[model samples]
Target: MKGMFNQFGGQFVPENLKNALDELEKEFNTAVNDVSFIKEYEYYLKYYVGRPNPLYYAENISKDLGGAKIYLKREDLNHTGAHKINNAIGQVLLAKRMGKNKVIAETGAGQHGVATATVAAKFGMKCKIFMGAEDIRHQSLNVKKMKLLGAEVVSVTTGTMTLNDAVSEAIKYWVDNVNDTFYIIGSAVGPHPYPTIVKRFQRIIGDETKIQIMEAEGRMPDYIIAPVGGGSNAIGMFAPFIGDENIKLIGVEAAGLGLKTGKHAATITMKQKGVIHGMYSYVLQDKEGNIKDAYSISSGLDYPGVGPEHAFLDETNNAQYVSVTDMEALDAFLYLTKKEGIVPALESAHAVAYTKKLAHTLQKDKIIVVNMSGRGDKDMDTVLKYLE
Candidate 1:
């Protein structure tokens, strides 16, 4: 298979798992080009997952900012309340096409797990989700939703008991059960084909935004912003616009406390090049190359490594990567809630926070689009604690 992401993405898995990766790549390549497969995927996206999600102009927020006009790509309104379902449904359909009867996935914030479980239930496939024990505790509502959707939620206790550990456990499970199970990775940070596959599946966000923005304003926005954990949503929102030189793409990473405090998940800003979780990317690692634990108030953005394509993009300066603090994201969350009445996911709020800052610096005629990747319903408990 061709190298992933301009030499930034490749399979670095155990020797035993090579064939499975190769097979998955082949099947995904074929499936993407097949008309019937595309049609079926589109059908589900429209009828089941609720496609063509609104691109709403945040007039109140824009007026408050008094600078760039802001528009929100409302992925939060999708069936499962997040952009995750876009990739989840696509991967599940691919698994069914490959004749896999069981699916496995890893999630941190539980949006991905819930999405996977939802698709599995709809398709009558057995599903298991690996999540960190800490995430299971903090994101209890999501865990409950997954279980109610008929998926077995496995709590991982290794390492920091968060996203990174859960991902490692999920990959190990896939390696051990490669034949009959399909592993649906939630982010764009996994091995070869996975980063590519997830990006392609989630790219609908950008594709739709491009058309919707053109129709609404008769031109592309000057900036597109989204939060980057493993970078699926940001990459999805940025891919289609990469060729539009006039459009700037900005990815916001989580600065848990602050970048200067050494307690952030700002991979592109603070990490170095290294391999983790079967892909070569910018990783938060020690001098000995050991992966370090990443911290973020938002579970979805608490990852040590970013997607390989994002690493490449940073290296090539094709897009800009920045960080937002927990306090900044919290302020934006409340600001949007009061100003626009939209409770953005904590992950998405990071982007919103940055957009607000950027809008202050730009002219009023300038436009910015923020991908509201998910809703805040799953984050009420966390938010309430922070508010208190």
Candidate 2:
């Protein structure tokens, strides 16, 4: 709960927005402890968002990996078909409780946007999503999905026309219309309260995993793994076990080509210190501190900068960070679908790939939990084309 400003979570918004952030922080802090708030939130999580998603043991995958046990935290089964829904529902409910009438957000692969739109419909609030022009083209399916749910998706044409630009545009929108608008950032990577807020919402993954592990193995997992884009999924899977010394948290980043090839989204794994989109964190940057371009087959993981909490975690050694290239991730994606009958999102496949590599080093009795952050149905076209 300490101020993480030094690690990229301080006030970075305009003066007019500072008061709103303060109010939001206050509300979030109070809501965390309020019994009625907790109960209501859990109710939505259970009935509306589908809580306690199954944790399945991949026996086939384990056998292929020399019998290294692999347990999947099936976040893909959550509402909206990804972990994004968890934070979206939580934030929308918070916005409603706070008397907000509008919700706005930025998204890349459109999963977050769709999830936000779904919650807005549930709460009957006006919703707007800002996406990069390029993302609109690559993620048109998600855009259509959002529109079907009555959310307006605006395309940002400036800058790189990608996730970062969409976020910048969303912030501008929020600034211009701050009174009744709530900007629901998709990841645990924004300035103050956001990293904390999103992580708290997504912590259900870890919470459920803890109980499942206790019930299944009679012991906690030796490690928890998830892919790191804006780091929400990874933080979600790690937050509940943060204070436990026995559990190790691992985050796999996208090494689009290879780390030295300078084309990957492996921010914390290879980047140096810099500031981007407001916070000081490890960024893929050049000598002038300008963010460098990043590439990844997974649209969700293609970012030049990582979440601030992830940077902090890497620095403090609270978690281990690894990177998997596009080829490696693709292979893992195919392997899971063929061997285990699970088609994993390319972003999530990065963690699965790492898990495969680490199987040789781990004892057969030791448990390793990987978050299947999303389903790969949206990426079937990309996969088919790649294979062709």
Over 18-83, each residue of candidate 1 has an lDDT whose tens digit, in order, gives: 888889999999999999999999999999989999999999999998999999999999999999
Q: Candidate 2's residue-wise lDDT over 241-316, tens digit each?
A: 8767788899999999898888888999875987666566788887787778778888889888877888888888
Candidate 2 displacement at residue 43 in angstroms: 0.7
TM-score for all models, in order of appearance? 0.99, 0.97
In model 2, the runs with Cα more than 4 Å from the true position are none
Query: lDDT score of model 2?
Result: 0.87
User: CA shift at 290, candidate 1, in angstroms?
Assistant: 0.7
What's model 2's lDDT at 50? 85
**Top-lDDT candidate index:** 1
Residue pairs with backbone overlap in model 1? none
Model 1 ranges with Cα > 4 A deviation? none
